[model samples]
Target chain A: MSYIAWIISIGNELLIGKTVNTNAAWLARKLTLLGYDVRRIITVPDNEEDEVEVFRDAIKRGVRVVISTGGLGPTFDDKTSEYLAKALNRKYVINDEALKLVIETFKLKGLELTEPRLKQAKMPEGAKPLPNPVGTAPGIWVEEDNTIIIALPGVPAEMMGIFENYVEPKLREIGPKLHFIERSITVKGVPEADLAPIIEKGMKMSNRVYIKSHPKGHEIRSPLVEIHVYVSSEDVRKAEDEINKVLDFLIFAVKEKGGEVLST
Target chain B: MSYIAWIISIGNELLIGKTVNTNAAWLARKLTLLGYDVRRIITVPDNEEDEVEVFRDAIKRGVRVVISTGGLGPTFDDKTSEYLAKALNRKYVINDEALKLVIETFKLKGLELTEPRLKQAKMPEGAKPLPNPVGTAPGIWVEEDNTIIIALPGVPAEMMGIFENYVEPKLREIGPKLHFIERSITVKGVPEADLAPIIEKGMKMSNRVYIKSHPKGHEIRSPLVEIHVYVSSEDVRKAEDEINKVLDFLIFAVKEKGGEVLST
Candidate 1:
């Protein structure tokens, strides 16, 4: 079974240019490394309706796992948890474990837990609270109809803390069996078309080999074309062998065309 | 009227972690700087069904401008233009201007225009072709029922070129009359709870003031709390005065409580 995951990055700071969203990219990289196919990464503002719509859209697309970052704080704009609960058609309740974590966090910081801070404890009914070792807001992990929905705080440190502590382990348990290997060969002094025939020949030899070309540098200058060879398989050894064969052929082909392979 | 924009980043590389999605972040920063409220940024794999669903979803959310990047190439995976046409129920045809641009681009590179390469010319009927001066793929600009949809090539350089050349001008002409201003003050030598009352008092005096506390550093040391104040309004002068009043009070209160305001 092929596992597909969707990412929803929720915040107005991202949309308003007040802050940069490194969360989606970081998560995409992590998920890909973990053998889960990140099908989509969506950024929605703090608006409840838009957040809810994105969640529904991911579900409709048959995403088995949905990881949402941001808007799980005590502030009024942090509406991700509420919208998520509403989308799942579940009532919002303060999970005891989340409440305990919040209280402990406040006590450690020597701060009184205010009403707004208490709001962080509220989660969707039947949701499992993922402990946030770094912050007061606990990440919520909910399972519905075999789909896993994880809600983590937008703060980078807290998000990472929760993911490492709870989400990562759960992901490994349920994730699909997959392996991917990639090799990129940078060719200089050769147009992409000149290398196309070689790439076509290589791809024809192996069904697992796929090639993509990217032009590098300014339009006026001699563009460097980097060809990426991707090989994916359930067996790691087979995937690596497929990638190695394509790389070997690509290097030879570039030299045959009187072009140098700058790097691989 | 407040304007809301939606960003749709399309690619399969994003899902598999082959590529980090820098497009969404860059687009968000640009839209925010242009004073447009970007409501959502969604990343989806290069799937026709997902593309169509996302387009419809963005329209239903009443977003005035929808900017989608990627899948405007000649490959089989590049189905965004066709799906966009099917979703809008518009006819699909080879836009003459776009075809000319593609042919001219290939000719400049001295590359033979293959059948797949020529496929870049086809676009949704009635859509305006936005010039991609740097690349072969041209962006498509479609306006339907007051909502504008822009389809740009996935290549980073090509997307930026088309957006800067065509889309930005059109967006500036029809955007909303709204502005956002933000200021942050770092408070040292005090816990957040003690600072909350002072901030609350300041907020009660000024309706436009918003205070957010961010804790920094690891668990072993005392975390630094930085408070951010955001003031948004159509009238710049009024908003500035409101922000200044709160800023002055916050500084005074922090000083009285034996805490220093690092900066404003």
Candidate 2:
């Protein structure tokens, strides 16, 4: 199973630069660590048309999982659930389970639910509501054919809470069981431009392992670069050994080019 | 003159959770402040097929300007310039100006140019190379019909240098001349759910001004919210006055709802 995923972050704030979209990065890290190939991280505005377009685009690409954050609030601009339903050609209605969760949450705070509060319970029909232990709006989880669609609140705490509590477990069950291994080493005294050919040779030699170099110092003087070596395989020991062998080869090659390995 | 812009960040490191995409956020902020309506921020791997597909999609969407970062280096994985040429149906060739820039940069450091270093000079036909003051790769700039396409190196310093020194001036000449004004006021003792109706009312009252509420405190207990009021208009005074009026109304309405304004 190819366990591919896409993160669709919906918010005008993100588009306008009011927010830095730490949410997307956080979710990307989590999905990658879970052995899913997170292929795209997309951000669009809160507009319903843009939201629907991005969602449909993800579906057309045939990714295994689609996760969206933001716009699941109570304001008029909060339209992720409704637009997602539109994109899926499903009915947008208040889920009874979601309503119950909202009522219980508000009741615990000694408050009564209102129309604005009721908006938190609305979701696409036939979707299951993931309980938000830290916030009011319940997260949405629905499966279409082979893809799993999820919507979480924009609040970092709420998004993290629901993701860790519900989404992680479900994803683990559906995703491929692959072991991922990675290692990084910093090299100095060699410019990244000069190190490129060696990296190319290393990648060609070990097709199973991926080697990426990040330039850390000035290209002209005091050159520094961080090379990341990683691989994934069905066998844990095989993945680990492959990465180690690639690292060894790359380290030896860098030394041969008069580059100093600063740290690993 | 809608001034629509899109930011494309290319890297596998971003997808694999090895690096955070701070470049996209920084560019989004710059574009927004320059009066460009940044519609989307897309991140993809270093794969050529993905890069070509995204570039074609952006062109098809008819955005005014498309700025892409990363994959403009010398490594095998760095294919942004070549794929962008293919997407535009232009020849991928070495430009004389870019080659001169690369040669001069290396010469200043008392170093000799090699094939890997020469790779940084290749760009699409009819594209102008924006000199990279900090790195080897010269940024690519090309125009097709009504859209402008640009590609910059992934290193933050190099990207920023080329953008600020070259791209910013060109963009300023083409973008809309609009003044943007924004203000934020934090309110405590009010849950975001309860504040939603007031936000809705405020938006209706001042449709020209955009009012967004960010939940700062927990939804149920010790509730705090930051209301951001902003507007953009051709007239600087008009934009400022409009946002201030909305802020005043929102503040007064919050107080009426028993919410205390903490900071502005």
Candidate 3:
């Protein structure tokens, strides 16, 4: 069976359009590459009630892993840890491991461990701390009702650092491993509508693969449309072969239309 | 009262990391500038049941406006229009206005109205067709259960064309209008941790203003940490004043910290 994951991006900046939410895309890509199916990405504000509701709802929706970014900072608006505890009906307390991470990070940065900073250590009972090397906030990882909840800091750099150093390895050990192979061909000058027939025909070449065309731009300086072919399976070789078959047909169609493949 | 919106971006490519979901960010920015709160941005695959569930659930959550982008093509995977109809319990039919748009678009492109292409006219009953000037698939606009559900084509150019030319004007007539004033102050040669104190102090200048510092990088060549100051109010001047007060203190602090404000 395949593993399903969901992302909940918690930040008012995202809802207000102050931030573009590059974190969801980054997490989705990482999870997908690691053989997990990232099914849904939901962005909510930093409100405590809404955060608790969304986090609980994701679990109710039957996702195996749920990752939330943002709302892990020292500011007043950051309340993911507190809300998450309430969502799962767990006790909220200052975990010593998480507190150590908070204290060490502040010491390394030559900053005092203020009360606001110390609040980052308060997490749900029985949750493990995912150390944040680049920032003061420590991420939380808890498993409940057969669902794994992972919360990362909102800052993109800190989020990426914690995921790469801690979460990725942990997920690799526990999450399902499926093989995914994707290929792309860049075609210039042909609009997506005009290539609909060719794309349809290319898709008929492989039932195990999906072929999608993304229109980049039609401007004179950037006349390129990218066709992506994706295949995933339990067997790496089968996935690779399926993707290759779809890509071969797509590349041939692009070349037949007098278009150039910028990348293979 | 401000109107809340939710975006449902349907496509496996977005989940698989093949696409960056620029449409959600674009729509969120537009709605926020026009005085709407985009509470949730959800990304799901092109599955019919999943789409229906998400659409129905968003309305249940009390968002007045729900917009979905993608899966409006003539391809096999294009099922958003059909699923949206099921979600609202509306009958599916070939809308006359939508059919005209599909025929005219294909006629102009010198393409035949093939059976698959004709499917673009199938829309929910009683829904108004938002003409797609850029593509064959026309967008659908429907009012159901006190919520407005809009479905746009997946292609960025086509989605944008319909949103700007049609839906935007219609929304202006119905959706709430809130003024959002956002100002930016970029400081060089200072880390976010070092500037957190100043940011906290600047925030006290105005309770109506919000100041967020985003660390770009710490290296000498890329030492720009952008501080965004935001204010939203019914009065345009009030919003402007609030943002300016926070930005003034922020800029002065940056200068005192041996940094520069590259932008106001």
- The DockQ of each candidate is 0.41, 0.77, 0.41
Tens digits of per-residue lDDT for model 3, B1-264: 438898899999889877787889889888888778788899999898789999999878677889999988766678898999899898989999988888887677676777777888998999999987766688999988778999998888889999999988878878665688888878887655557678889878887787776667742234678887887678998788778767777888889988877877
Per-residue CA lDDT of model 2 for A1-264, tens digit only, reads 558999999888888888888888889888887889999999999898899998888888788999999999988899999999999999999999999999999889888798988988988889999999898899999887778899999999999999999999988887787667889999999888888988998898777888999998887778899999888778888788788777888899999999999888
Stretches of model 2 off by over 4 angstroms after superposition: none
Please identify which of the two predictions, 1 or 3, would achieve the higher DockQ against the true structure: 3
Cα lDDT tens digits, model 1, B1-264, are 547788888876776666666787788777765668777777887788889988987777677889998887655557788899987889888999888888888888777787667777888899888888776778999987767899998778888988888888778777655466778888777655456567667778777666666655442245466777776577888888888888888888888988777777
Model 2's CAPRI class is: medium
DockQ of 2: 0.77
Is candidate 2 or 3 superior in lDDT?
A: 2
Over B73-108, each residue of candidate 2 has an lDDT whose tens digit, in order, gives 888889899999999999999999999998898888
Contacts from the true interface found in each model, as a fraction, amount to 0.41, 0.70, 0.41
Candidate 3 residues lying further than 4 Å off, grouped into runs, are: A187-207, A217-225, A248-263, B187-207, B219-225, B246-263
List residue ranges in candidate 1 displaced over 4 A. Answer: A56-62, A106-111, A191-210, A252-258, B73-76, B105-117, B189-220, B225-233, B249-259
lDDT of 3 at A53: 87
lDDT, candidate 1, A169-261, per-residue tens: 878777765666788888888665456567777877788667776657543257578788876577988888878887898888889988888
Question: lDDT (0-100) at residue A176 of candidate 1?
Answer: 64
